[model samples]
Target: MTIRLTVNRERWWNHVVGVADEVDGLIPVVKGNGYGFGRAGLAIAASKLSPLLAVGTVHEIVGLPDEVTPVVLTPTWRPPDTTEPVLTVGSNDHIAALRGWQGRVIVKLSSGMQRYGGNIDLVAAAQRAGLRTVGVAIHPPLAGTDDDHRQQIVDHLPDIDPSLDVWVSHLFPSTYESLPDSHRYKLRLGTYLWHGDREALHLEADVIDTREVRPGDRAGYHLTEVPGAGTLVMIGAGTANGVAPLSDGRSPFHHRRQRMALLESPHMHTSMGFVPAGDPCPRPGDWVDLQRPLIHTAVDELRWI
Candidate 1:
């Protein structure tokens, strides 16, 4: 028994292709648990759209298909020996480390977001250091109106070399389209590209064991008392599988049977959920419906449908 992510292949593929077609220069960000589909899965999907695939670290570059060129979004701690990625340079230290480094680099400029980037002078420093410049990267916040942040990019535009392109992340479709033609923009997208439609995906956990319990019975790792008489179900997902408690005390219950049950804290590779005495009790090996953010899921546990 195991927890798995089930993706509606047909619908999800349609959306992936649609987004690629709409965004002329799309560089799909396939990093960090691969956005719930694993790095290889999204990398394969991104290859169908463009030759460029964006990754968060250099370690993730190995499994990707050879046809795709990896653009590492994070600064490299040490010079990687295997692949020459389109690197990200956000500071003078990043530029200094690239003294003898070869290959293209993107100068990360600061937007109002205030994370992972530096002033526009870093671009000139990188050029002075003799590193090949591909373009500039900007990660903008999506909260409220993005106009002020978009304006920030415009203000920094003069700092960038006219020949270089611009790569931006977390921009709304409207903001992406609103950029002036004077600048070439490539959208580095992850959630918006892969998990755009939540309806296209679902997750389920198989029931591994079940035990009948009465009210006041202790249950789970913490041995908390059961509120009422019901069946104690051992599910196949836990903290190891990236199942976490919701911040607002909400449950990711999608099935009608799950609605009548109380989900308890998950263990390493299993979880305990209590179904009320009147509700249908799941048998061993039965699949229980569940949902969680794709970003929190482990890659190997996914089973694409």
Candidate 2:
């Protein structure tokens, strides 16, 4: 009836627990559609390791279990409703605005990513502003080399106080092993923790309807041309579920590298794929394997088995 995300339970859980055991200080990040498992679900999953959960906003903390303490990653104007949320302040202005909040704070430093955080002066300003600075957060870029990432951390070490706890993202295993023994380093893991073993996860959407299409026939919202005679296979997934539209004339057909009919861009809750006249076409009710990540797509149900 809808897109379903199936997880190999044993494999997935083993990976999850393995990450928790392998990492010394693990702060599991459960944000952004919960990286496909949903935030609340991942929150429960991570509770076994640590009571701490990192979310994108204060709003995401509502449904989390009482045992978990949420750390809000982004700057927010709204106060947390419950769970004594830890606030992140990237700039002096942010720290100044959050002066009313008496809860623990983590000063985010500007790594090479440049998305958030401030210079060393802001960290000092945060402490001076009466904010109880408990930890320092650093989010590194994903594309950089090992040397580049290590240098990124080394560059920020002088700015960070050794007494404060350190949290990092996108850090390599080798980098974690080499950290100074003096500081308590907690790695903020999300995709790498949940989706690390890609084999453990599978995505599939049901084929709902099929129809014949002839060359030059009008179809879809914009009346996209049907290049040739084929069967149009409509699948249960669309933009509403975070399915992205085709880009740069790209389609699943290009990625699959097959000679079958082209797969068109998805609709709001449905997408059409052309199966050429000569090729075997999938009948309605069959499922189509999806290449998209669950984080980028919403589904009606999840099968954890």
Candidate 3:
């Protein structure tokens, strides 16, 4: 069936705002399928709002439209001839590895976050070399506030140059907002753009069919039989759609129809059926919006619409 339903990019765009204005600026986070909104789409949309925000890495930067102003998380090595990203940093031999870069860059700070930032020594070296230390990002303590860690940062940076901007905390938008001023230093926001303080939005595929049956009748790749008279509705987006389950712990289908996952079972055929708007119950050849939450999971396997 024709999956013609719109993704409601506007709905997503309209909701792409901060919950509060107390913060200084907006930095939309773009990572992992742009949180399923698609990188290019969200980047283009976010550009309409703020030019500054954070992208996870160099790969994400390439997907961004030129209009996108970026603070790439930790820019990978680039030749000096490669110039575009406004800010990003490196550690170890990162500067030499960068070959040559003209845009602004930050020395990644290894605070409580043990990810790909910098240590105090790296920051010192960057400063001595006169590399632009636009900011230092503290990516950790994500689970909760760490007052001792905050003080530790204060104590640890005693010799740090004040010209280096402090970008202490950056997590989901809510966490960024929750951080006390001492911890906020400079909050980096990601999930907050699509999911501010509000609860997550859910999508569910619908079961289009149920049938009454008995012991012998067979269905699906395994020739499984219907235990009872129940209908099988088809609901699944295959390779064509970005429905492939992700390895990341975050499950996009948390609220989606459970059957969507079942359809992927190798033993069960996942084709579905549907009718277009104002049409009769869909027969084969009818168009449908499988992307629609409720309608996606209800059709029977092999029941192509």
**Per-model TM-score versus the true fold:** 0.93, 0.93, 0.64
Stretches of model 3 off by over 4 angstroms after superposition = 1-15, 18-20, 63-68, 111-113, 127-130, 145-159, 169-185, 197-213, 216-229, 239-305
> What lDDT tens digits, residue by residue, belong to model 3 across residues 1-305?
22222244445445664332445555667765565545666677677666675777766667576776677776576533345665556576776565344456777676665667666677666655556556666555655555544554565455456666566554444444554444325556556556452323333333334333345556655666544433343543433443333444222222123222222232132343222222233323333333323212222222201
Q: Which ten residues in a row have the lowest lDDT in candidate 1?
A: 253-262
lDDT of 2 by residue, 1-305 (tens): 58788999999999989888888888888888988877778788888888788888877878888898889999876555442889898987788787767778898888888887888787788878887888888877998786677677777887677988888878766678687676678888888899999999988778899999888887887778887888888877777887654454444322133523445667688877787787767788887776676778787788988
Whole-model Cα lDDT per candidate? Answer: 0.80, 0.79, 0.50
lDDT of 2 at 70: 88
Name the lDDT of candidate 1.
0.80
lDDT of 2: 0.79
Cα RMSD, each candidate: 2.0, 2.2, 7.6
- Give residue 86's lDDT in candidate 3 (0 to 100): 53
Q: What is the lDDT of residue 121 in candidate 1?
A: 80
